[model samples]
Target: MDSSKIINIIIALFLPPLAVFMARGWGQDCIIDIILTIIVFFPGMLYALYIVLKD
Candidate 1:
Protein backbone atom coordinates (compact mmCIF):
# COMPACT_ATOMS: atom_id res chain seq x y z
CA MET A 1 0.00 0.00 0.00
CA ASP A 2 1.03 3.61 -0.53
CA SER A 3 2.03 5.87 2.34
CA SER A 4 -1.11 7.96 1.90
CA LYS A 5 -3.29 4.88 2.09
CA ILE A 6 -1.46 3.77 5.24
CA ILE A 7 -2.00 7.17 6.74
CA ASN A 8 -5.67 7.15 5.80
CA ILE A 9 -6.08 3.71 7.33
CA ILE A 10 -4.49 4.91 10.52
CA ILE A 11 -6.84 7.88 10.52
CA ALA A 12 -9.74 5.60 9.77
CA LEU A 13 -8.95 3.56 12.87
CA PHE A 14 -9.25 6.70 14.93
CA LEU A 15 -11.61 9.15 13.22
CA PRO A 16 -13.49 7.17 10.65
CA PRO A 17 -15.64 9.97 9.28
CA LEU A 18 -12.69 12.24 8.85
CA ALA A 19 -10.80 9.51 7.00
CA VAL A 20 -13.76 9.00 4.70
CA PHE A 21 -13.96 12.72 4.11
CA MET A 22 -10.28 12.81 3.26
CA ALA A 23 -10.69 9.89 0.86
CA ARG A 24 -13.98 10.90 -0.78
CA GLY A 25 -14.45 14.56 0.07
CA TRP A 26 -17.77 16.09 1.19
CA GLY A 27 -20.20 13.71 -0.48
CA GLN A 28 -22.48 10.71 -0.01
CA ASP A 29 -19.66 8.44 1.13
CA CYS A 30 -18.62 10.96 3.72
CA ILE A 31 -22.21 11.36 4.84
CA ILE A 32 -22.61 7.62 5.10
CA ASP A 33 -19.38 7.32 7.07
CA ILE A 34 -20.56 9.99 9.49
CA ILE A 35 -23.89 8.26 9.92
CA LEU A 36 -22.24 4.91 10.44
CA THR A 37 -19.91 6.48 12.99
CA ILE A 38 -22.87 7.92 14.86
CA ILE A 39 -24.61 4.56 14.84
CA VAL A 40 -21.52 2.44 15.68
CA PHE A 41 -17.80 3.11 15.76
CA PHE A 42 -16.28 -0.17 14.54
CA PRO A 43 -18.54 -0.46 11.54
CA GLY A 44 -17.69 3.11 10.64
CA MET A 45 -13.99 2.33 10.93
CA LEU A 46 -14.43 -0.73 8.74
CA TYR A 47 -16.41 1.30 6.24
CA ALA A 48 -13.76 3.98 6.19
CA LEU A 49 -11.08 1.36 5.57
CA TYR A 50 -13.22 -0.10 2.81
CA ILE A 51 -13.60 3.31 1.21
CA VAL A 52 -9.89 4.00 1.47
CA LEU A 53 -8.93 0.61 0.03
CA LYS A 54 -11.63 0.41 -2.63
CA ASP A 55 -10.17 3.19 -4.68
Candidate 2:
Protein backbone atom coordinates (compact mmCIF):
# COMPACT_ATOMS: atom_id res chain seq x y z
CA MET A 1 0.00 0.00 0.00
CA ASP A 2 2.85 2.36 0.72
CA SER A 3 5.20 3.74 -1.91
CA SER A 4 8.05 1.51 -0.82
CA LYS A 5 5.92 -1.59 -0.96
CA ILE A 6 4.53 -0.60 -4.33
CA ILE A 7 7.99 0.03 -5.69
CA ASN A 8 9.21 -3.32 -4.41
CA ILE A 9 6.32 -5.17 -6.02
CA ILE A 10 6.90 -3.43 -9.30
CA ILE A 11 10.56 -4.26 -9.20
CA ALA A 12 9.82 -7.86 -8.34
CA LEU A 13 7.31 -8.18 -11.16
CA PHE A 14 9.72 -6.76 -13.70
CA LEU A 15 12.92 -8.40 -12.45
CA PRO A 16 12.55 -10.75 -9.50
CA PRO A 17 16.23 -10.92 -8.66
CA LEU A 18 16.30 -7.17 -8.32
CA ALA A 19 13.91 -7.21 -5.38
CA VAL A 20 16.07 -9.59 -3.38
CA PHE A 21 19.14 -7.89 -4.72
CA MET A 22 17.91 -4.59 -3.33
CA ALA A 23 16.83 -6.10 -0.03
CA ARG A 24 20.13 -7.85 0.60
CA GLY A 25 22.67 -6.95 -2.08
CA TRP A 26 24.08 -8.02 -5.42
CA GLY A 27 25.55 -11.42 -4.58
CA GLN A 28 24.77 -15.12 -4.18
CA ASP A 29 21.06 -14.37 -3.66
CA CYS A 30 20.69 -13.05 -7.19
CA ILE A 31 22.31 -16.22 -8.45
CA ILE A 32 19.83 -18.23 -6.45
CA ASP A 33 16.94 -16.26 -7.88
CA ILE A 34 18.09 -16.93 -11.41
CA ILE A 35 18.35 -20.64 -10.67
CA LEU A 36 14.89 -20.70 -9.09
CA THR A 37 13.39 -18.84 -12.04
CA ILE A 38 14.95 -21.33 -14.40
CA ILE A 39 13.75 -24.34 -12.43
CA VAL A 40 10.19 -23.09 -11.79
CA PHE A 41 8.31 -20.14 -13.12
CA PHE A 42 6.90 -17.74 -10.50
CA PRO A 43 8.81 -19.37 -7.68
CA GLY A 44 11.35 -16.63 -7.95
CA MET A 45 8.53 -14.09 -8.09
CA LEU A 46 6.95 -15.38 -4.91
CA TYR A 47 10.32 -15.60 -3.22
CA ALA A 48 11.10 -12.04 -4.12
CA LEU A 49 7.73 -10.84 -2.87
CA TYR A 50 8.17 -12.76 0.35
CA ILE A 51 11.57 -11.25 0.99
CA VAL A 52 10.46 -7.73 0.16
CA LEU A 53 7.11 -7.88 1.95
CA LYS A 54 8.47 -9.76 4.94
CA ASP A 55 10.73 -6.87 5.84
Candidate 3:
Protein backbone atom coordinates (compact mmCIF):
# COMPACT_ATOMS: atom_id res chain seq x y z
CA MET A 1 0.00 0.00 0.00
CA ASP A 2 0.98 3.69 -0.28
CA SER A 3 2.60 5.68 2.52
CA SER A 4 -0.53 7.67 3.25
CA LYS A 5 -2.55 4.47 3.63
CA ILE A 6 0.16 2.97 5.83
CA ILE A 7 0.21 6.00 8.09
CA ASN A 8 -3.54 5.96 8.39
CA ILE A 9 -3.43 2.27 9.26
CA ILE A 10 -0.95 2.88 12.01
CA ILE A 11 -3.01 5.67 13.45
CA ALA A 12 -6.12 3.56 13.18
CA LEU A 13 -4.50 0.66 15.01
CA PHE A 14 -3.02 2.82 17.74
CA LEU A 15 -5.83 5.32 17.85
CA PRO A 16 -8.86 4.57 15.73
CA PRO A 17 -10.42 8.02 15.90
CA LEU A 18 -7.13 9.72 15.03
CA ALA A 19 -7.11 8.26 11.54
CA VAL A 20 -10.77 9.10 10.94
CA PHE A 21 -10.30 12.53 12.47
CA MET A 22 -7.46 13.22 10.06
CA ALA A 23 -8.96 11.59 6.97
CA ARG A 24 -12.56 12.82 7.15
CA GLY A 25 -13.84 16.39 6.98
CA TRP A 26 -17.08 16.18 8.93
CA GLY A 27 -18.53 15.33 12.34
CA GLN A 28 -20.81 12.65 10.96
CA ASP A 29 -17.87 10.84 9.44
CA CYS A 30 -16.11 10.76 12.76
CA ILE A 31 -19.22 9.47 14.47
CA ILE A 32 -19.57 6.77 11.87
CA ASP A 33 -15.96 5.78 12.29
CA ILE A 34 -16.45 5.44 16.03
CA ILE A 35 -19.57 3.35 15.54
CA LEU A 36 -17.83 1.08 13.07
CA THR A 37 -14.92 0.61 15.43
CA ILE A 38 -17.19 -0.23 18.34
CA ILE A 39 -19.24 -2.65 16.31
CA VAL A 40 -16.37 -4.47 14.62
CA PHE A 41 -13.95 -4.52 17.55
CA PHE A 42 -10.69 -6.13 16.28
CA PRO A 43 -11.34 -5.31 12.67
CA GLY A 44 -11.54 -1.60 13.38
CA MET A 45 -8.35 -1.03 11.39
CA LEU A 46 -10.02 -2.33 8.25
CA TYR A 47 -13.03 -0.13 8.92
CA ALA A 48 -10.81 2.90 9.35
CA LEU A 49 -9.05 2.06 6.10
CA TYR A 50 -12.39 1.91 4.35
CA ILE A 51 -13.33 5.29 5.77
CA VAL A 52 -10.03 6.81 4.65
CA LEU A 53 -10.14 5.34 1.17
CA LYS A 54 -13.81 6.20 0.75
CA ASP A 55 -12.80 9.82 1.18
Number of the predicted model whose lDDT against the real structure is largest? 1
lDDT of 2 by residue, 1-55 (tens): 7898889889988789888888878888778887887888599988888878887
Q: Write the per-residue lDDT of candidate 1 for residues 1-55, one digit (tens) a residue.
A: 8899999989999999999999989999999989999999989999999999998
Question: For candidate 2, what is the lDDT?
Answer: 0.84
TM-scores, one per candidate: 0.93, 0.75, 0.61
Runs in model 3 deviating more than 4 A are 1-4
Which candidate would rank higher by lDDT, 1 or 2? Answer: 1
- Candidate order by lDDT, decreasing, is 1, 2, 3
- How good is model 3 by TM-score? 0.61
Which candidate comes out best when scored by TM-score?
Answer: 1
Question: Across residues 1-55, which tens digit of lDDT does each residue of candidate 3 receive?
Answer: 7898888878877777679888885588778777777887556667777787776
Q: Cα deviation in Å at residue 7, candidate 3?
A: 1.5
How many clashing residue pairs are found in candidate 3?
A: 0
Residue 41 accuracy (lDDT) in model 2: 56
